[model samples]
Target: MAKTKEAAMRTKNLRGIVRLSALAGLAVGGLALAQEAPDRGIVHVGGDLYRAHNNAHNTVFLVTSEGIIVSDPINRDFAEWLQGELASMYDVPVRVVAYSHHHWDHASGGEVFADTAEVIGHETMPGALALPSGDTPLSDAAAALDANGNGQIEQSEASGNLAGQFALIDADGNGMLTGAEIARGPVSDVYPPSTVYSDTRTVTLGGKSVELIHVAAAHSPDMTVLRFPDEDAAFFVDIISLKRLPFMDFPGLEDVDSLIGTIQAVEAIDFSIGVGGHGDIGTKQDVADHRGYIEALRDAVAAGIADGQSLEELQASITMDEYSDWGSFNWLPNNIAGMYRILGGGN
Candidate 1:
C-alpha cells in the first residue's frame, strides 16, 4: 500500500507537469519574445481567454458572449491596442477591467477602459494608488540616460540605463521612445477601481465565472489571484516566478509568512495551471516548490539568527545554492538580508 501510494503521488506529479507543459507553451514562447513591443504579441489560451505579452508584463483578457473582462492594461498604448483587438476580433465591448495589483506597470492604462468597463480591485488598491508618485523628471534623468546629449532619449541610449523605465518613458503616441520623449520623463496614471472587495468577489461575465481572491500585504497590499474555475487557470504575480528567481528586493514582499501561506492556499485550490505576472507558466508543484524555497530560506535565516550571526555573516552563510541556477542570483543576498530582518525582529 505504501508503494502504491508513492506511485500514485508520482503519477499525480507527472500529470501536473504534462498539463503545465501543454498550457505553458505560449507562456514560454512569450518569455523569448519579451524583447518585442507590448502590442506585438498576444497569446490565445483556449476558449475565450487570451494573454498579451507586453514589454515588462502581461495583460490577460477573456471574451464571453456578454462582453469582455481584462486584467491589467499595462499602459495606455498597450490598452488601446488590446481594446482594438477586442473590437476587431469579437466586436464585444469591455464590461470589466480587473487589476491584479496596483503597480504602475500593470494597472496604469485602466483609464482607456473607463468609458465602458467597471474597474474592480481589492479594497487596499486605493491606498496604493494614493501613494506618492515615483516618476522621475525627463530633464533630471535625461543627462544620465541620454547618451548623445541630443536632448532626446534614444532606444540605444535608454537601453543601457533605462531597461525597467521604458514602460513609463513612452510619452509619444508611437510605441517606441525618442530622445525628445525621454526629455519629457516618466509618467504615472492612477485609475482607482470603482468596485472594491475585501476577501473575494465572484463575477460571472458572459458565461464564465472568475474569482478575485485577495492575498493582501503579500506582493502588495492589493495582490489578487484571478481564478477561473472552469478553465482551471489562475493568474498570480510576484510571489511565484516559475523557474526563475523573483524580480527584486526579496520579490518585494511585505510579509514573508503571508506569502508562504498564500502560496499554500493557492496550491490547495483547484487549479491545473498558473502564471505569474512576469515569468513562465506554473503548476501546483511549482507553487509548492516556491513555498519550499521561502520556507527553507526562512529556516536558514532563522538558524543563522539563533546562532547570533551578523547580517553580512548570515548573507554569506545562508546561500540558497540549490536555487543558484535560477534567474536572479544577485538578488539572493537581498532575500537573505530581508528574511534575516524579518526573522530576527529587526527594524
Candidate 2:
C-alpha cells in the first residue's frame, strides 16, 4: 500500500543519513494536548529536563552543553513551533528526537528536528509502523467507529484525526482504512527511529543522561518509558496518563496481564517526578496510583467475566466511582469494554 511505501522510504532515507554522518565524524539527533485545550508553554521538570506543552499533550526535553534531546513532535505545526522556540531559547540545536512509542499522536512531526537530531525508539517501532495486516488491534473508541463491524473503517465512520483524512490515509484510495491508515491518522509523515534499541539503552550528551526502557504494553508494543536521571523525572507516554482516566478503550490494547507487567517495569525505575504524555505533572506516588488503577480495573473485569456478565452488564456493575474525581471519568464504559475484550469477554 502507499502508506507502506512512504514509510519505508522515510526510514530508508533516515538510515542512509545516519550512516553517512557516522562515517563523516559522528553526527546529530533531534505535542498534543488533552481536553482540546490550546494552552502552550514550557516548565522546568527539574535540572536540565523541561516539559513543553501544547494544550493537553506535552513532550519532555533535555538540554545540555552538547545539544538538546526531545521526545515526540506531536504534529507538524507543533514541531515547527517548538523548533522556533528551541532556536530562540537555546544555543545548541536539537540533537536527539526520542519517541515514547510509534503512536502518531505522540511520535509524528519528527521531521521538524530531523536535520539536527537523531531519531530514536525501541527496535520494535519499525515493524509497528509498517502497514499492518488486518490483525492490528483497535482501541475501543476506534472500533466503535467501525459501525458496520467490517474490518475496514469507512470515511463516514471517521472522527478526530481520521476525519477528512480519508483520502490520504486510504493510501490505495479504496475508500477503506486498514489498521495502518487509522493508526497513522492526520500526520503528514512519521520517520521511524534510525537509532533503535532493545530492552534498555541510554543516550548521553554533554553531561546529562536519558534512559529508555522498552516493555510489553497494551497501548503499543513499542512503548518506551523514559527516565531522566539528572532531573529525577520519567516520561511514559500513553502507557500511563496519571490522574486521568484511560482514553476511550485505549486503542491498541490487547492483554491485561501484560499491561500490568508493563506498569511494574515502570515502577522499577527510580524517579520522583512522573511526566505522563498527557495530564499534569505527577509524583512517584502517581505512578503507584496509576498502577493501582489498572490493577483495580483488571480485577473488576476479571470478576465480571467469571460471572459471565455481558460488556454492558459489567459496565453498569462496575462504575469505578472511586475514581470519579479523575479526569474523563465518564470513559469508564469504554474502559470496561477494553478490559472485557482483553479478558476474554468477547466484546
Candidate 3:
C-alpha cells in the first residue's frame, strides 16, 4: 500500500509539472506572437543581401545575383511565409537551400525548395535523409513514434508532430546511436543535398564568392558554416542562434571545448555581419556572447553533477534568467537539457 501511494504521488507530481510546462509554453508563445519584428531579420544589411527571421528557429537569406540560400527553413508554415517574402523581395528564383545540420527546425522545409533550387549540405546529408525515409534504424525509431498505434501520424498528434516524427536513429545500423545521430537525426522530408562536401567548398554565384566551411562539431557533426567573403558576411548555422538560447541537439556537446575553440579559430576571418540559424543578424559581439553563454552553462551543469544533483534537478534548476532578455527564451529548456547531458558525459 505504501509503494502504491508513493507511485500515485509521483504520478500526480509529474502531471502537475507537465501542466505547468504547458502553461509556461503558452505564455511564451503569446509573447512571441505579440512582439514586434526585429529590424535585423527584415532589413537589408548590405548590397543585394537580405536576412529574414521566421519565428525563433530559422533564418532565410536572399542574395541578389545568387537568388536565395537559406540556412534552415524550420517548418512548412514558416517555409511558405519565407517563399512569399522572397518572391516579394527579389525577382529571381531561389537557387540554393542549405541545411546547417539535419535537425527539423533547420532542414524540414527543404521540400518547399526542392522543386526550385538545388539543396546542399555536408556529405552526411544523404545519410541524414536515409535515416528519416525509414532506411535506417534511427528512421525506424522515429517511425515507431506513433505510440497510439495509429496508422498515420498527423502533424497534430503528440508523437506525430514534426519534431517527434523525425527522432534521430542509429546512423551506423549497428544497434547503437552514434554521436552524429544523437545530435542530428537523419534528414527527413527534405530532399537530400545534390552536393555534399566533407571538407571545404567555395563557389562563386552572381559574382559573390560563397565559401562553405565545415567546423568541428559544436551543434551537429554534419554542421557547416557559409561565408560570403566579398559581402563580408558569414552565416553560422545552429552552432549559435541569435539572442536565443544555444541548442545542444547533437551529441557534439561532448566536444564543447573544441567547439568553442573552433569558433574562436574562425574569429580571425574578417566578416562584418554574422547570421545564425535562428534569430537576427548580428556582429562579432554576438559570437562572443554565444561562446560565453555555452561556457557558463557547461560550468553550471558540471557543478550540478559535482553537487550530486540528479539530471532532472539540474535541468529544472538551470534558468535562462540571464538570457531572459534574449529574443528566444522559449528554447531555453531544451538547450539546458542538452548542456546537462553533454556535461554529465551522457553524450
Residue 281 lDDT in candidate 2:
90
Candidate 2 ranges beyond 4 A from true positions:
1-37, 132-163, 167-188
- Give the Cα-based TM-score of candidate 2 against the true structure: 0.76
Give the lDDT of residue 161 in candidate 1. 32
lDDT of 1: 0.70
The pairs that clash in candidate 3 are 128-187, 138-169, 138-170, 183-250, 183-251
TM-score of 1: 0.68
* Model 1 misplaced stretches (Cα beyond 4 Å): 1-40, 131-188, 251-254, 345-347
Model 1 residue 231 lDDT score: 74
- Candidate with more favorable, higher lDDT: 1 or 3: 1
The lDDT for every candidate, in the order shown, is 0.70, 0.78, 0.62
* Stretches > 4 Å off in candidate 3: 1-41, 132-186, 248-252, 265-268, 307-324, 328-338, 345-347
Model 3, 231-320: lDDT tens per residue? 788787766665766653434466678778867855655787887766668887888887788788788888888888877787789885
Deviation of model 1 at 193, angstroms: 1.1
Using Cα atoms with residue i matched to residue i, what is each candidate's TM-score against the true structure?
Answer: 0.68, 0.76, 0.66
